[model samples]
Target chain A: MSRIVLRNLVKSYPGGDRRATDEISLEVADGEFVVLVGPSGCGKTTLLRMVAGLETPDSGSVHIGDTDVTSLSARDRRVSMVFQSYAIFPHMKVRQNIGFGLMMRKVPRPEIDRRVADAAAMLDLSDYLDRFPSQLSGGQRQRVAVARAIVVDAGVLLMDEPLSNLDALLRLQFRAELKRIVHQIGTTTLYVTHDQAEAMSLGDRVAVMRDGRVAQIGGPLEVYDSPADRFVGSFLGAPPMNFFPALVSDGPALSVGALSIPAPSSLARFAGRTVLVGVRAEKLAVSTDAADGFLPATVEVVEPTGASVLLTVRLGDHELKVQAPPTFDTRPEASVWLRADPSTMRFYDPETSLALTV
Target chain B: MRRFALQVFCVAISLFMAAPIYLITLAAFSSRESLNEFPLPLVPTDPSTETLSGFLSSTGVIAGGVNSLMVGLNTVVLALLIGLPAGYAVARYAFRGRQPYQLFLLLTRALPIVVLSVPLARIFLTTGLYDTTYAVTLLHTALALPTTVLITAAVFVAVSPEQEEAAQIFGASPVQAFVRIVMPQALPGIAAAAVFTFVMSWNEVLGAAILTLNQRTLPAQVLSTLSFSPLAYRFAGGFALVVPALLFIAIMRKYLLNMWGTTLK
Candidate 1:
């Protein structure tokens, strides 16, 4: 029943040129998992630390379950965190690490043991409870950190790049386990990471941050399908969105070097002004044979990426990426044709870099 | 060739360090008649306790031993009490003058102990602590603090601040987190500092001789009297001084070894 609400949070580090987190406000519904994803120094981690009471904002009010806890220290707040390095005490065995929060809370001995045993079983660490962190593998250590965080019954759980230290295969495997465990515990969470795939897979909703401000916040598929800005579109997907510089001509069509795209009515007012046309790499179709309305491109590189093939092609003077079936046979420097559905195209203002209304 | 050369170098260094202690022990325990023989045997051939027993039975030896042990142990405790916090602060915080403060600590040792001894003795004399073990203990603590602060600061820096933040977020107060998490991890460093302090205090003769007369510690007492004693008795005193430092290091070796295994995977 604990929901987190932040109001107008602004923070700046000493000697930093600009604010680390600008005037930003956000809310996470009860039991919701929200992830903050951005490039380095985008203020996503700073925003999460503010909520966790680890970093105090220059100006903000934090509310947990309707309680204004802006002045409370981290120990007084009902929050738990899993650090990037795990931060497990090397001297403490697994059981002690899991039970540390409970012990600090003055929970009874019997209850602490019961909860620790349950958490151990949940994390599949029962057999390793007596072993120290030095004896555990990286994945096991990460699981121990998760177990320690969840055993506290905190109102909110904060994590900062917790899975970024693991290997790729472990990260993929642990991603599902983490989402499932968080849902089962029903604790509100605010996770921060630079990895887009982790943000998409683990969060119920992703908040895309840029320059200390949230560029967009929406469901995973919603943000992926329609990004709010050029930055958001390019940041969220693999291969990113390929942008082509164009001009808005009559009929609100985009006029590039040799092609005219019929844009939506939103571009009608800027009919004579310049704009950028953005399309996802996966949205452009590749054809080996020539067809009408398909622009010819020179295949510069063919990358077979397990499930699909990504081809970098040169159309006119611009290079673009197109997704094709993995089995699609192709060779370097070969000629190919490409096309895209008009609805899949997004138009952006070049100056502001914001997505134009569609 | 390199491996063999390295092993030879290591053995050479070990023998260079161990030879003096072995020689003193042999000289201390040998019979008075046997010690008179020229080109003394490198090995223990005539083991006896005549000179050692005579030195032990001499006046004020046991009392000086007791005073030395008190001063050494007290120096270890006081130095750590004052130094550990300064170490943690220097490691964790970045307040103004931090770099200057560390430099200042190093500079304190740059002044020779002899120059500071007169002013230090005058201060103690004015405070009516001239002839007490407390004066020696205070002097030893001041001498030991720079090394203690630098070493423990390095250890605290190696200990992750994230662990302390995690503890605070988990419901422990700042003090409690330091006690439960930081202190245990800092033990090996503290032990190393203690070993250094104890040995320095135990062997320091100039300050102890100037500070105390009738209440002199073993080293100061030995220095005041050993020039007039026989050579065997001097060897006996050397044997006695070396044994305690060796024992203290032995007791602390466990924690010193714990330093390498302190990190999480």
Candidate 2:
């Protein structure tokens, strides 16, 4: 039931060479699911570990509700974490592992039993209570790890890539199950992962990180549609947004490769500056003739997915991917025209990779 | 043709290793009059029970064996008590001077023991620890410590830190997490360390010879009495040495694979 806040937290290892977390500041509202997403080695996991008190921050403070727990040991933090490997005690039975936390606090034997049984039933681990972790399958071990955490009933839960070890099908299944469990408990949760889809589907709000800094923080769709910068746009989408190097023009059109694409009226001020155009694959329509916002492209390859066909086209030196319906026919070396609606195309400052207006 | 020769060469070397031990056992089982004959009797005409019974009946031989057992068990317990915590700290923590601590352990094993023997003898005499079974046990701890630390540290390293952290998050304190979560996983390693330490202490001759006189350990007793004592006593003592080492190796066979694997790494 506590809201957690981290202010200007910094964690650097000895020799000052590796900064595991650098100036990270975040807040999680009570009962909210806040996901921290980034590439590997991007410090998202480091930030979460600091919050759990597994790592000490070199600077700034971590506040759980009104208490500043910056210098507290992990045992004193009253926080639970689910590790990527699950880390269930291989020797102990599921019930003993689940009740370990209670036993440590010296809770009465009967009380520990009651709570452990309750947690097992909640996690659907009741049937496997007597089994050792080695005896269980990967998915069962994951549930036992969750059950161990739930038995503690900590106010906040920190999950570090908890589903990363599961197979794709299991990951999806557990992602939904985890959401339901977290929602049912209504505990404040901070989950860290490198997977964009995991962040999008599970997080109530997502914080996209790059180079140990949060690039953008917003609802999944908000960050996907209206990225704070070009990095966020490129990182969030699958098949990635296509980039075309273009020069700003005085009229309603800009020359890109060998074709002109419609420029929004707002770009009239920057006539000579170089700009990059972002066209999402699904937004680009392939046809025979040039249309209002069309650019001609020479098809390099047509890759078929069951649902959609992606046409990789050569536009001067740059390659652009155009998504078309599965029925669309275009062979290699074929000349095809692709168009994006003017409102859907994103613009970026080529020099800085920062998003530009219109 | 070359591979067949190499295999035969290895088998011949093994037999060379085994021949003297086999000859000694056969000679000890023979009677004193039969043993007097060199190059051995193909089958002793007068193999008798007198020599085996006489060796077993000797007070020094029996006392030395008992003392060796005590010293070995004591060394194992003492080494593990100190080594487990030191190993865990060295493996898991990143406090200042950690590299220096590791270097110090490596230095302990690197130096020749002969150089330390006289100085250690002087120190033990001043401390009133000379000529006692406990003194030999204490001396064996120094010999066992470095191996214990290295082996146990490797064991702890293999037990992931993330698991301990996960235990802490589940509400166990650092100490509790180590006891409940970490210890169970590293038990096989600790057992292996104990067995190694016991065998090292049991096999030691130099330290035991320098430390004790009346309560001499088995190897020290055997070495001192080797030329003077009857062949039967020497053979029985040798058998004792080989027997325990073989037993320990058998008991700790599983960890040998891991120990060698880790050593290779």
Candidate 3:
């Protein structure tokens, strides 16, 4: 139960100009779970490795609680890591794997046994204590990895895509289980994953990363609702946020193809300029009726996903995806009216791809 | 039809390899007179232990056998002690000249041991190590080290670095991690390497024959006495030399399979 902080971390591989992790700084509160989420190669895993002391940053300091641990080896840093492959010692049985750290530190036999039993019980691995790692299924091996980390009682826990190897259903099940276990243990944890859904569901605060930089860091809803840039805005949502090139006119209305909608007053100064407008699929309302402010469109495709139907509508030359109730099914080539809530609309600078205040 | 043909081919190959060893074993157990018979009787009418007893009773042959076992064990121990860490370093770390170093190890195999043996004997004499089992063991280690390093490197490369990192993260030092985690997984392959080293040292003749006089290994002693010894003695000595090599393979067969099978994930 300690805060972990990283300061201005930069790492670059040999013969490469681009830094793997560029000048990134973040802080995790005691018992808080912060997830670094991004696409592969965004350096989220590298950043987590730096915190774990598995990697050394070109220039950075890592602090666990009040002590600087940048120069410390992984063993001296008192941090436990759960790797993507689980990395359970295939030769050791479940009990030995969980009790390894304590044995390494020369803990008393009874104490190690007690702690290992406790962790095994918590992870529902008591029955498999005598079985080797190869005998366990993927999910069970992952639990043994967690139990190994938990029994150490390290101040910080680092996990790198721990659920990426499991099937979708198992990932979902273990995602909730991992959150529950971490919450119960109350260890400050830094988790990394490329899945935005996993990041949102597991993290107390999610840090969205792009190109070795922290694009945005906030609570899940805050990040989803108010992404700091186009990358973050587009990367966080499924059926991702749609962007349309629009012209801001004198009346502060945005014109896209043949349709025009009134813009928020904050964009009045950018009149007559071209800007990118982003709206999430769920934020757009589709109707069969032609309302006054609704833009007319022709439906190109309808996808029903049990809870909701995703409609791909062609608005002039551009297509927009609208999330509609599953009950609201319509054939392709049908005419529909689409409207976006003014408050939920995001405007971005076309050149920089940065979200503009609206 | 295709599967049956393939099985037949494999059986043919097995028999082809086994024929020479089977013939030698039969000659070792038969009377010397039967061995000299026209067709060379495939089956001995009266199996006699006379040749084996005569071979075992010879003082020079007994000393050679003991020397060979000692040299084999010593060479294996020394080669593993020096090669395992070097192999682990090459497999686990990135350093300057790693490729060149491995290439150098491979290149050593191209230089025949005979070319180095005379010079090695001269140096051994100057260093007061000549005509001793230790001199032969040192030369054998040098001969076996290249293969030992390469095999052990391939073995260690199959072990994941993440397993070691997991141990380090769990509060074990790098050395402790290697000892407690990496070494256990690598044992089977190391055993295979040791077996190879032992059999190699046991059967090597040119270097041992040139390097040692009174303390010659079994193969060296057998080669030096080949022209003078009776034919029954030759067959008995060949069978005796092949026995230990076969036993080493039998002991290490499981580990050899494991060594090849453990490809890192």
Q: Pick the candidate with the highest lDDT.
A: 3
Candidate 3, pairs of clashing residues: none
lDDT of 2 at A28: 96
Residue-level lDDT of model 3, residues A26-95, one tens digit each, is 9999999999999999999999999998999999889999999999999999899899999999999999
Q: Write the per-residue lDDT of candidate 1 for residues B182-262, one digit (tens) a residue.
A: 989887787887888899899988889888888999998888998798888899999999997788768877765564444
Give DockQ: model 2.
0.70
Chain B TM-score for candidate 1: 0.90
Highest-scoring model, TM-score: 3
lDDT tens digits, residue span A42-117, model 2 = 8898899899998888898999988999988888888888888888788889998888888887899999999999
Q: What is the lDDT of residue A224 in candidate 2?
A: 81
Q: Is candidate 1 or candidate 2 better by DockQ?
A: 1
Sort every candidate by lDDT, greatest first: 3, 1, 2
lDDT of 1 at A215: 94
As for TM-score, the candidate ahead, 1 or 2, is 1
Interface RMSD of each: 0.6, 1.3, 0.8
Candidate 1, residue A279: the lDDT equals 88
Ranking by DockQ: 1, 3, 2
